[model samples]
Target: MSRKKRIAIIGTAGIPARYGGFETLAEQLVRQLGDKYAITVYCPGPKYTKEERKTSFQSARLKYLPLQANGLQSIPYDSLSILHALFSADVLLVLGVAGAWLLPFVKLFTRKKIIVSIDGIEWKRAKWNRLAKCYLWWAEKMAVKYSHADISDNESIQDYTAVRYTSLSHIIEYGADHTVQVTPTAKDKEEYPFLHKPYAFKVCRIEPENNIHLVLEAFATMPGYTLVMIGNWKNSEYGSSLYLQYSGYNNIILMDPVYDQRKLDVIRGNAYLYVHGHSAGGTNPSLVEAMYLGLPVLAFDVSYNRTTTEGKACYFKTAADIAAIIGNTRLAVLRENGFRMKEIAHRRYTWEVVARKYDELVQRVLNNKGKIPVTPSVATIPAEQLISYELAHLQAPTPFYEKR
Candidate 1:
């Protein structure tokens, strides 16, 4: 038999999936594709201690870089990883667009295939400064333009890319089957007394773009109900301020990040409702995980969230909206919503499904010559003829004109 093709994964905090969506994606990809490919994952050195670090995970090799995997340091971290990967890897599976500025060089100088997942519309996020946003915006363009294959996590994002880049982006969302339902033990009850009562649960980075403040404001007024929110509160000034303001509420429980999967599942799976406040990003792992656990969802009113839930879950656009929905909705209706979410998750959000999609993309990119565009045959027709034929709607730059 011939040798296995080498795959290098870049743009994650490291494995054992201690962080957010991309880390978990990396771990699952390794488990799913390790047998078929010689995979090497680049991790952040500063995030792991000597004891936690390992040379390999499962069948994939692990390489550590000195720079952090996110924020300002991510630029160099991803740049260096791509440079190192060029030596021997046949393909570069990039998870984000932070280092996409170098992708043009890679495409121009090297023959290695690039399969990049543009992890949401990063430049549109509120956390980045003007310069950072500009850089990210340009980087996103480069990532889509230069890669052999590009992926979007939601249909809304795919539509956005089809309009902006005129490229047919593959839609591959994150898997949530790794999240399990757990029963709270007697000891767990002692540790978390809130487990005995009904509460709305939410876990996300304490970012402004996530609409955390709006969620807190809504819950603060609902003194009769409890909100158990988990996040890294001390990591940022916005989070710290929210913690200070909301921690004093009798009905709100603001807790730190719980890395123990069982403990988190126990708290999350037991909640009566899951409140997803994210106003940005596509197909969030936390939201999907909650759905997989059969929890009812009240997500923010946004196109991305709507696409993820398939317009089946309740939505809130403001603090008043959240308060009114929770205060008025019947328990039976909420339970039914939870069932709908679970059905969707089971059908679309499993590791096996996601892995197979990635495998197909990998095989295609390995043999493909150039990226495909979703531009329609109608686009090639004369504009004057389209107007004369009453087909002017097709002239609009959107995915609606894509071939059926």
Candidate 2:
């Protein structure tokens, strides 16, 4: 009998993911792969209580650290977790670029396999200051350069890495199977009166990059259309001001973050349409979850969102675009969009598929086979030639070559 491989999952807040994408990914990976691998997960003490911090979760061991898993402290937290795992684990499955500065040393000194997921292009996020963004940018380079395998959650991110780092990043998007299509109970309707009405729903961090202001402005302009947006309204001054400004609107219901899974699902699943304002990040978990709930998405017009939805959903670039779509789009079109979105979600965004990809990548890394070849950063051929030859569906030349 062969011994099971030892794996360490680092960079998440904790198990029983209370928030965010990486945490949820970590949780799902553990649940699916626990039996096959001897997994040890690092939990940040700030996020989990002493009572909640048992020695183990599911079949995996939990190691608690006395620091926050996010922000500046995550650097130390992830570094310490990596150092501790170096002694015991065969593979270090790191979820973010927070402690990527230590990866070069880990790769140089230890035999442990380092697999990293650069959680979207973190440096591009509007929340981070210039200094923080610089550090993140550097860390991202280090993580990609040093890791045995790198992951990108969306094809757009993969394209970015392929062009920037000349690295072949495994595309493993977040699973949406965890999200259920919930019917509002009488109690649910009593608790959330907005459940009874036809409204567009959105739930995300109230950040500048997410375009919360744009969504609010769009809904505000059209009094007939209702918008139910849930987020951490008091987390920042921007969020606070937005809440104050929009909460008074009869059509726009600005609610605080709702962590309860079923409660959130019921509200989201019952919506007439799901509006995704996020302009950053790759394959947002919330967006995919909405697709799983059979909701038509009105996503921000961006390559990342387009890639995630496979260009099947509606898109908006501005407040007016969103407002016009809501006002003009027929219910039948919305239903068709929802069905197509659901089909895409069912085929691509399931945990079983995601876990299988991870498992394959891990095995390939451990075996020292299927290593990504070093490719030149620059393309040899012009964009016009490549598109003309590769894209058979394009009847006319691409807009870039149309003028030529």
Candidate 3:
């Protein structure tokens, strides 16, 4: 048989399976594409060890470098990974835009197929400073432009890329198959006291984009339902104050990050309703996982979310919307919505399909197939046309509820 596609995966904190989206994406790629691709994954190693270490993972190669996989060091670490991967891998399937500064060099020298997924709109995030944002924006442009093929995880993202870069992008979202219906163990309850309770589930970075405060405020009023949100709550004054404000409330549990899969999935999968208040990011991995497990979704009613949920799941834009959703949307209706979300997940967001897409793209790019087998001159939807779909359904302020 012809040689299997030698593939390199970069831009994750390496994986023996943790919970982050990049890691989960890598894991799925390995799971579904292992037999078809000779894979190499770059991992973080100790800088001071100053020594040799075994390189490889189960059925795939591992190359460990002496730098953190995220933050500033990610630049050189992923850059180095790509440099090394050029040798053994037929395709470079980079995940993020962190190491994109070096992408030009790779393009200059190698015939290796380049496929990149610009993970959300990284430059628009609040975490980056002005210079960082500028660097990231350029990096994002380079990643999309230089790559033999590019991926966008959400339709909104695709729209952004197509509008900005004037290039068609592959829309490949995060798969939720990594999540299992795990039961909380005895040790889980010891670790997390809230594991025993009936609670709503939320896991995300505590940032303005996620709308954490909105979720907290809405949940604070509801006494019957318990809310358990996980994030780096101590990282900011906003997070700290919200935690302090809601800590005394017996119904709300503001927990820190839970890295263990079995421990976290139990609470996540068994949640009464998965409260997804994320106002940013493309098809969020956590939200999709909740959908995959058939948890009732009440997401922020943005195009990104409405598109992710296929415009079928319930949504909320504000505190009142959230309150009305929880109060008015009956349990049976919630269950039906949960089923609807799950049906969408199983039909559209499966690892098998994702892996197949990646595999096909890698092959197509490797053969230099210029582009996918779609007509180049199709009628593209305008921005206003895209937004009009949701605007038509947007609920307006009720005049009957006016204070006058």
lDDT digits (tens) for residues 260-314 of candidate 3: 7766788798887898988778889888889999998989988789989999888
What is candidate 2's lDDT per residue for 207-311, written digit by digit as tens?
999999999999999999899999998999999999888899999998888989989999999998999999989999999999988899999999999999999
Deviation from native of the Cα of residue 15 in model 2, angstroms: 0.5
Tens-place lDDT per residue, model 1, 273-309, is 9999998899999999999999999999998999999
Off by over 4 Å in 1: 378-398, 401-404
Each model's total of backbone clashes: 0, 0, 1
TM-score of 3: 0.87
TM-score of each: 0.94, 0.92, 0.87
- Candidate 3: segments with Cα more than 4 A from true spot: 47-54, 183-197, 372-404
- Pairs that collide in candidate 2 are none
What CA RMSD would you report for each candidate? Answer: 2.8, 4.6, 7.5
Q: What is the lDDT of residue 248 in candidate 3?
A: 88
Q: Pick the candidate with the highest TM-score.
A: 1
